[model samples]
Structures are given as C-alpha cells and as structure tokens.
Target: MRAYERLLNYVKIHTASADDAECVPSTERQFDLARPLCDELKALGLTAEVDEHCYVRGWLPATPGREDAPCVAFIAHVDTVPDFPGEGVKPRVIENYDGGDLPLGESGRVLTVKAFPHLPKLARRTLIVSDGTTLLGADDKAGVAEVMTLLEELNEKKIPHGKVAVCFTPDEEVGRGTAFFDVLRLGADFGYTIDGGFEGEVVCENFNAAAATVSVEGFNVHPGEATGIMKNAALIAAEFAAALPADETPATTGGRKGFYHLTDLSGNVETATLRYILRDHDAGKLEEKKATFERLVASCNEKYGAGTVKVEIRDQYRNMKEKIDETPFVVDLALEATRECGVTPICDPIRGGTDGATLTRMGLPCPNLGTGGFGFHGPYEHITVEGMDAVVRILHAIVRRVSEMKK
Candidate 1:
C-alpha cells in the first residue's frame, strides 16, 4: 500500500489516549492498531511481540555481512491526541493541490489558506487531510506508517544494516507512552522518535514539564442568612489560576518560551479543583514556575484558613539537552540523515514534550525526528504525501549510516 493509504488505514482506528486513565496504555482500544502492526512485522520476517497494554515491539535482524554493526532503534507512538474526536474519520487525498482551500466533510468545513498560510506550500503536492468533522489522527500515526514502510523497504531490498529495534508506544498523547517502555529489553545503542512536525526539523531538546493540581475546600452556608460564613471554592480556584503570569501559555508563547497552562477547573461553593501544566526550557525557570504555584497556594491557605488550599505538583519530564550532550552522535546522525534526504535541517527546541524526552531521562539518548505534519492536536491537522515519503527516505538513510559507523 502507499504511504497515504497506510495513513488512511491507520486513522480508521480510534486510539485516543486519555490523560486521566491509570492504565499504562490509557485506553485498551489502542491495541486495535498495535496488534495489526505486530502481524505486519511478522509477515516481513521480523521478531514481533505485542504486550497487554498495546506496546508493540519488533526486532529486524541484521542483513547478511552486517551482523557486528551497532544497533539502532526507530520509535513511534500508536496513540492519537484526545484533544479531538478520533473516530469516524473520512480522509481525502487532494492530488496536485492547486493552492486553493479544500472543503472537508459534508458539514461545509473548509481548510483555507487564509487561516493557515502553510497550506499553500503544499500546493501542487498531494496531501491527506481530515473531513473537518473529526481529527485526522496524523499527529504520530504518520510517524508509525513511515517507520513501518521503511522497515518493509529495508527488508525487501536486502539492505545491509545492523540490528534495528522498532517500538510502537501508547499514551503518548497523554505524556505517558514511555512510562512502561522496556528500554533495556529493546536493546539499542541509541534511538530516534519520529514524532515531531515539519520535514527537516530535528528536536534534541524540549521543555522541562510538570503537572500541578490545586484543590480548595470551603464551607457552604445559606447565602441569605450567612453572608460572611459562606466561602466560594470556585472563586478561590480562579484566584489560584490568576496568580500565574498571563503571557505564558500555549497560545501566547512559542520557540523556547514556556508558560503555565490551566487545563481543567471545576468546583462548587463547597469545593473546587484547578489543574495546570508548567513548562520551561530553562531548569531554573521551570523550578521557579513550580515554586510560584506553591507560594500562591500557601498564601491562599493562609487567608482561607489552614488546610483550605492544597497543591500537588508532579514533574513529568526534563529537557533532553543534557542527555543529548552525552550522546552527540544521535543528533548528528539525524542532521546527516536530513541532509542526505535533500531537506534543509532545522534544529530547534521543542516547546512541548515528546516520548523521546522521557526516554532520554531513562538513559536511552533518544532524539525526535519529524513526520512533516502540521496543526497537531487540532481540527486542521494534515500531512503531505511527499513530505511523508521523504521522511521515510530519511529514516532509511539514518539506519544505513548508523550501521556504517560501526567498525
């Protein structure tokens, strides 16, 4: 099947990962995509295994005469973001885009160049986009399809290479894909996560991330008879969120600028809860951001009475720069592969976290490669057919180069 066909087929599976689920895979339905990947790997004569949580693992043996080379890994996540509806997707391939807006779905939805200027860049190129009624699921499934296609290509061509490990993870949308990943068991000298956007973009660094949850307790009394006795927990929760800097949010900042994102808030007059995500590229600033939240909570508790406000902050992942420093060749190989594919390489810090970020902390030294997608986690999500194929070529080149590095 073609790359676009693979993407279209994969999008039909609903793998929306949940942030609140306690399970490793978050949602069991993600296995719908993982199980079939295992079968495909086996068909290509690779050793494949699928776990209960939908984490699919495969090992492609070295080609003849390259058994002693250094092993490398290509990683992708099978889960899609839960921010949009991932079910009942209807994808259309616009062949030779004419720099005009393409209407999606029967709902009269259109992806206009006026809204996204990047649409015109793909003009005259084939692109697969959603019907505008639901998400296209290209966030990382595009990465999965590309990686699998490359593996099949290598196998069919009898390309000489070292051991290559493949891992299709779950819950990446909720930032937990790497939580249950067996890094050591997979056994690679280094790896790359093809889970980012843009064709030439290579991300070896990302923000230090943390999740903070604040709870407020208040006593409720009849408002008519208890004007002073009634405390509104929802108001207190609003105050806690308002204490953060106004300019730091996903909508307000870009390119290394970190911000506090208030993801959820709900409460009544008696109780309320506020959820926030803190991020920063600088370690010092990241710590400061967390400290600011704690200080705000402490101050609120003092005014609202002791134990009235509580804050729980959890560190999610740290910047991968230090980890990449220890394994510089990983980034180098990514750059080399991009140039070999005839794409201009652009090295930048990821404003958000990737599974590679957590894997780096786990001692894997994983960097992120791009899948040439844009408008991730939203309704305008799309992927260009040529961009997807070029990335596949890049992956193939990276694998061959890393094996050639082996003495």
Candidate 2:
C-alpha cells in the first residue's frame, strides 16, 4: 500500500492527547495506535514491544556485512494535538491537483495559491486534506506512515541497512512523549524524527521552552462595603495579560524568533489563573523571556497587594542543536540523503519542540526530518502524495548511506 493510504488509515483512530494529564501516555486512547503498530512490526519479522507507557518499539537487525555500522533510529509521535478535532478525520484526496484555488468541504473554505503559494510545486500530485470540519492529523501521522512504509521497503528490497531502531511515542502533543521513554532500551547510536514540515527541511535546533502558571488571589467583599478592601482577581488577570509586550507573541513571531503565548485563563473575583507557554531558540534569550515574566509578576504584585499574585515557571525542553553539535554527522547524513534523492536540503530551527529534542537531551543525538506537511494543528493541515514518496526515498537513502558509512 502507498504511504498516503497508510496515513489515512492511521488517522482514523482517535489519538488526540489530553493536556496536563498526570499519566505518561496522557490518554489510554493513544494505545489505539501504539498496539497496532507493534503488531505490524512483529509481523515484519522484527522484535517489537509495546510497554506500559504506550511506546511502540521495534528493531530491524543489521545486514550481515553492515553489522559494524552505527545503529540508527526513526521516531514519530502517535497522539494528535488536542488543540483541534482529531476524531473521524475524513481524508479527501485531490488527485492531479491543478495550480489554482481548490475548494474544501462546505462553508466556502478554499485552499488558495495566495495564502499557500508554495502549493504550485505540488501540482499534478495527490493532495490529502480534510473536509473543513476537523484537522487531518498529518502533523505526525504522515510521519508515522512514512516511517512504516520505509521499513517495509527496506525488508522487501533486502536493502543492506545497519541495525535499525524505530519508536512510536505518545503524548508528544502534550510535551510528555519522552517522559517514560527508555533511551538505553532503544539502543540507537543516533536517530531522526520524521515529524517536520516540507520536503528536504531538516530541524536540529528547537525552542528552549517553558510553561508558566500565574495565579491571582483576590480579597472579596460586599459591594456596598467594598471600599479599599476588595480586589477583583479577574481584573488582575486581565491586567497581567495586558502588561506583557503585545509584540512578543506566537502571532507576531516567526523564523528564529521567540514569543510568550497565553494558552489558558480562568477564575473570577476570588481567584484567577492564567497559563502561558514560553519559547526561544537561544538559551540566553529563553532566560530573558522567563525573567520578563518574573518581572511582570513582580510588577503586578507591587501594583496590587504583596500577596495578591504568584507565578510558577517550569522548564519544558531545550534546543537539540547543542547536543547535535557533539556529533554533527547525524545531521549531515540527513542532508546527504536529501541530495541523494535530488532534493535541496533546507536546514532550519524548529519553531516548536519534538520527541527528537527530548531524546537528544537523553543522549540519542537525534534530529528531525520533514513529513511534507503544512498548516498543521488545524483544519488547514495537508500533505501530498509526491511529498510522502519523497520522504520515503529520503529515509531509505539515509539508512542505506548510514550502513555504508565508516563509524
């Protein structure tokens, strides 16, 4: 079966991750995908296991002469982001796409060349999209299918590849994918995550990220007798929101730029809570962004009462480039593979975190590769048949090249 067909099949399973869940996988539904993946790997004559954490792992033994070559890995996430509807994704295929505005489902939604002009390059190829009611889940499902199909190709063609390790992680959308992952068990010298966007794009650097929670304690009193004694927590929450630099936000930031995003807000007069996520590729800049929040919280406390507000900032993940620098060939291998497939490689810093980032920090020397998806995490998400085919070639080239490389 084609990779796109595999993608459409996997997306039918509802694997949307829950936010702030205490468990490793976040939701048991993630196992819906994990279990099947392990079974498939086992059927392919590989040792596969599905642990309690919902991580699907499989090993493809090295070819006879390739035993001394370094072991490599391919990683992808199972859970879709809860930020959008991930259930019952009806993948609409636009075959032989013409270079013009293509109408999606009802509601007058159209995928136009103006907004996504890069689409012209995908003309005459099959485009997999949603029906305008839900996200297509191509964010990582495309990655999953591409990796799966590559393994099948390697086995059928009897390709001489080194020891190949594969992992399907859960809850990456909630930033806890690697929370229970066992890098020692994975046993790969290095790996590449196929969860990136666009063909030939490689991601080695990702944001130094943090999640913050700000709480406001209000002193409530009767309106008639509330003179100088009542403080509205909701108003303080609004004030806190207003105080941050309006220019520094996800909406305002782009390539290599950092931002503070307000994710959730709740509460009223008695107590109020505001949640914000911070991101920056540079460590110093990330610290500055965190300090900026601390400064803002201090100012709010000073402007209000002393004990009126409290803030907690927790580090999420750091840039993988620092770790990738230790062994640069892992990235160079991907670039070499892209060229081998006749695609120009575009190396860029990740705008968000990935499972690779966590694995890199855990000593796997992981980087990221593209899944040829764009406008992810929303109904606008899409991937092309040509794109999927290209990535498969890329992965195949990377593996075969790695097997031939001298450690």
Candidate 3:
C-alpha cells in the first residue's frame, strides 16, 4: 500500500493530544491509532506491540548476511497538536496541483501561492489538505505512513538490510513524547525520526527549549476606590509581555534565531498568569532567556511587593546537535541516502524541537528525516503524494546503505 493511503486512513482517527492532561499518553484517544499500527506491524511479520504508554514498538531481524550491521530505528509521533482543532479531519486530495490558490472545502480558507512560496515547486504533484475545520494530521502521520511502507517494501521485496526497529510514539505534540520512553529496551544503535517537513530535509540541530509560567498576585479593590493601593494583576501581566523584545518572537524570528513566545495568558484583577515557551539553538542563550524571565519577575515584584510576582521555569529539551555530532555518521548516512534517492539534501537546523532531540540526549543519537509534510499544526497542513514516496525510497536506501556498512 502507498504511504498517502495510510495517512488518509490514519487521519480519520482523532488523536489530538491534550496539553493539560497529566497522563503519560496525555489522552486515551492516542491508543486508537497505536493499537491499529501495532496490529499492522504484526501482520507485516515483525514482532510488534503497543505498551501501556501508547508507544507502538516493533522490530524486524536483519537479513541473512546483514546481521553484523548496526541496527537502525525509525520513529514517528501519533498525536496531533492540541492547540488547533484536530478532530473530524476531512482530507481533500488534489491530483496534479496547478500551483494556484486553492480553497479548502466550504470553510472559506484558501491555500494561496503568495502565502506559501513553495507551492510552485509542488506543481504537478498530488497534494493532500484538510477541510478548513481541522488539522490534517500529516505532521507526523505522513512520517508514520512512510516508515510503514518502507517496512512493507523491505519485507516483500526481500531487501537486504540490518535489523530495523520502529516506534510510533504518543503525546509528542505536548512535549512529553519521550517521558516514559525506555531507550535501553528498543536497543537500536542509532535512529532517525521521520517527523519533519519538506521532501529533502535532514535536521540535526534544534532549539533548546524551556517553558515558563509567570504568576502575578495583586490587591483587588472597587473601581471607585481604585488608588495607589490597587495593583491590577492583568495590567501587570500586560506590562510584562510588553517588556519582551518585539523582534525576538515566533512571528518575527526565523532560521536559528532565538525567541520568547507567549503561548497563554489568563487572569483577573486579583490574579493573572502568563505562560511562555523560550527557545534557542544555543544552550547558553536559552539560559539567558530563562534569566530574562527571572529578571522580569524580580522587577515586577520590586515595583509591586516582595512576593507580588513569581516565575516557574522548566527545561523541556536541549539541542540534539551536541549529541548527534559525536556520531556524525547518523546524519552523513541520511544525506547520502537522500542523494542516492535523487532528492537534493536540505540540512537545515529545525526551528522547533522533535522527539529526536530528547531521544538523542537519551543516548539514541537520532536525527530527523522529512516526511514531505508542510504547513503543520493547523488546517493549512499539506503534503504531496510524490513527497511521501520519496521519503519511503530514502528510508529503503538508508537501510540498504547500513546493511552494506562494516560492523
């Protein structure tokens, strides 16, 4: 079966993860996709199972003469981002795209070439998009489909390759994808996360990330009695936001630039909370970003009261490049595989984090591979059928190259 076919079937199942959920999988609905994926892997003659945490793991032994080659693992996440509506995704398939502005079904949302300059390059290719109501789940689902198709091709064609391991993870959209991951058990020497955008992307570096929650406490008073004593928390929170560098934000920054993104803010006159995610490719710069938050909180407290403002900062993940550099072969092999498949290699640093970032730190040394997906995390999400096919071919090439490598 083709990779896009699998993506169409997988997107119909709602697997949007919740950010507020405290469970390992974050949502029980993730199991909806995990169970079937495990079953599919089992049917493919591989040992596969879905764990309690909704991680679907599978392994296929090396071909007869390739036993000495290093084991290679592939990973993809199952859950879509909770920030957008992820349920009821109705995908629209456009055969031979004309590279013009296309309107989504009835919702009045248009995918315009002017907005997305890459549309011209995708001309004449089959494109898949969602009805403007929800996300298409192609961010990682396309990756999942490509990996599945790779396995099927390797097995049916009797392709010579090393041991192939795969894991379909849950809650990746919520930053907890690897919280319960047991790296020692899956046991692949090195891996690739099939969770990236575009056809030829090979990502090794990503942002060092951290999340901050700034809480404000104020004295609420009647509007008529509002004087110097009344410190409105909402106003203070707004001030805090204004203090941030306007140019250093998700909207303004691009390509290796660090940013402070305010993801959520809620409060009243008495109390207000601001949640921000800080990201930078450099660990030192990330620490500086965190320190900026601390300084802001201190400045606010000094003006109001000693304990008027408080901040809680938590480190999410670090750049994987430090770990990936130790074993440069992982990236080198991916680039070689991409070139071997006639796809020009795009080795750009990821603007965001991936499951591979945490996995690489956990000793897996996994880099990221693209699944031909674009415009992720919203209704505008799209992918090309030809792009997914290219990824599957690249995966096969990577396996073949590994099989030919000396232990």
Candidate 4:
C-alpha cells in the first residue's frame, strides 16, 4: 500500500489518549489501532509483538553481514491527542493546494492561509487535511505510516540495513508513553522519534517539565449584605494566574525560553482548581520557575489563611540534550541522512516535551524527527503526501548512513 493509504488506514482507528486516566494504555481503544499494525509488520516478514498494554514492537533483522553494524531504531506513538476529536475523522485530499481557504466540515469551516500563515508553503502539494470538525490524526500517525512504508520498501528491495527496531507507543499525549517502555529489552544503540512537525527538522533539546495543581477553598455566602464576609475561590485562582509572567507562555516564548502555562482552570465561589504546566530547558531555571510557582502559592495561602489554599507540584521530565551531547554522532547521522535525501536539516530546540526526550534521559540517546505535518493536536492538523514520502526517504537514508558509521 502507498504511504498515504497506510496513514488513512491508521486514522480510521480512534486512539485518542487521555491524561486524567490511570490505565496502562490509558484508553483501551489504542489497541484497536496497534493490533493491526503488529499484523502488518509481521506480514512484511519482520518479527512483531503486540503487548497487552498496546505497545507494539517489531524488528527487521540486518542482512547477514550487517548485524555487526550499529542498531538504529524508529518510533512513533499510536495514540492521538485528546485535545481534539479523533473519532469519525473525515480526511480528504486536496490535489495541488491553491494556497487559499479550503472549506471543511458541514458547518462551513475552512482551512485558510489567512488563519494559518504556513499554508502558503504547502501550496502545490497534495495535502491531507481534516473536515474542520474532527482532527486528521496526522500528528504521529503520519510518522507511523512513513516508518511502515519505509520498512516495506527495505524488505522488498532486500536492502542491507542494520537491524531496525520499531515501536508504536501509547499514552504519549498523556506524558506516560515511556512509563512502561523497556528500552533494554528493545536493544537499540540509538533511535529517532518521527513525531514532530516540519519536514527536515531534528529536535535534540526539549523542555524540562513539571505540573502543578493549586486548590483553593472559599467561604460561600449570600451576595446580598455579605460585605467582607466572603472570600471567593475563583477570584483567588484568577489572582494566581495574574501573578505568572505573561510573556513566558507557549504563545509568547520560542526557542529555549521557559514558560509557566496554565492549562486548566475551573471551580466557583466555594472551591477552585488551577493546573499549570511548567517548562524550561535549563534545569536550574526550571527549578527557579517551580520556586516562583511555590512562592506564589505560599503567598496566596498566607494572605488567604493556611487552610484556604493547597498546592502540589510534580516533576515530569528533564532536558535530554545533556545526555544526547555525549553521543554527537547521532546528530551527525541525522544531518547526513537529510543531505542524502536532498533536504536541508533543521535542528531546533523543542518547546514542548516528547517521549524521545524522556527516553534519551533514560539512556537511549533518542532524538526527534519531523512528521511532515502541521497544526498538530487540533482539528486543523494535516500532513502532505509529499512530506510523508520525504520522511520515508529520510528514514531509509538515515538507516543506510548509520550502517556505514564507524563503530
């Protein structure tokens, strides 16, 4: 099957992962997508295994003499983000985009360049986009399809590739993709997560992440004649948000700049809860950001009484660059692969954390590559056919280059 056809097949399976869940796969539906992938890999003459938790592992053994070459792996998540609807995704292909607004959904919503400034660069390309109602599931599905197609090509041509390890992970959107991952069992020297955006992009640095939950208790009273008798929880929550640096959010900051992002806020007069996602590339600066959050929480509690507010902070992941720098050849292999594929490699810092970031910290030396996709985690998500093909070519080239590397 063609790469686009493979992506469309995967998109038909709803694998949206949730953050607030406690399950291993997070959602049972993820297996629906993963099972078929395991079968596909096995049918392609590769060794494949589908775990009970929806973790799919597959391997293409190196050609007889190529086994001594360095083992390189490729990974992509099976689950789409819960931020958008993954069910009933009506993906349509626009043959030769005109760089104009393309109407989506029955509600008359359109994918317009005026709204997404990056659309023009995709003009003249065959774009697979959603119908404005549901997400296209291109985030990592594109990556999955690209890898699968590359594997199929390598097998058919009987390419002399080093052992290629592949995995389809679950709950990446929920920040626990690598929680149950057994890296030692997979046994790859290094890997690449084909899970980011922008073709030709390589991400080796990502944010050190943390999550904070602030709970507030308020005295609910009758509004009339209440005077100073009532303390509003909602007001306190708003005050806490106001105290954060406005310019540090994802919208305002780019590159290595850190941010305190308030992801969710809810509750009323009697009780309120605010969730903040903290991020910074520098460990010290990341701690400083957390300290700032704690200090604000303390100040709020001191002003509102000891029992009025409660704050809980949890560390998520740390910077992977420190570990990645130890294996500089991994970066060179990717750059060399990009050049071989006739694309200029774009190496940049990741503003958001990824499974690769955590895996690298876990001693796998994994870096992130692009999915040839854009507008991820939303209904506007899309991937170009040309882009997917480019990624497949890049992957094939990267494997050959790594095989040629001096051990």
Q: Which number leads on TM-score?
A: 3
Which of 2 and 4 is the better model by TM-score?
2
Residue 107 of model 2, lDDT score: 38
Error of 3 at 307 (Å): 2.3
Clash-forming residue pairs, model 3: none
Tens digits of per-residue lDDT for model 3, 267-317 = 999999999999999999999999899899889988999999999999888
lDDT of each: 0.88, 0.90, 0.93, 0.89
Q: Which digits, one per residue and each the tens of the lDDT, describe model 4 over residues 248-341? A: 8989988789998898999899999999899999999989998897788889889988778888999988888989999988988888888888
Query: lDDT of candidate 3?
Result: 0.93
Which residue pairs collide in model 2, if any? none
Off by over 4 Å in 4: 105-107, 217-238, 266-272, 298-309
Model 3 lDDT at residue 32: 94
Off by over 4 Å in 2: 106-108, 222-232, 267-269
Off by over 4 Å in 3: 83-88, 220-232
Task: Go through the candidates in order and give the clash count of each.
Answer: 0, 0, 0, 0
Q: Estimate each model's TM-score.
A: 0.91, 0.91, 0.92, 0.91
Q: How well does candidate 3 match the true structure in TM-score terms?
A: 0.92
- Model 3 — which ten-residue stretch has the worst lDDT? 220-229
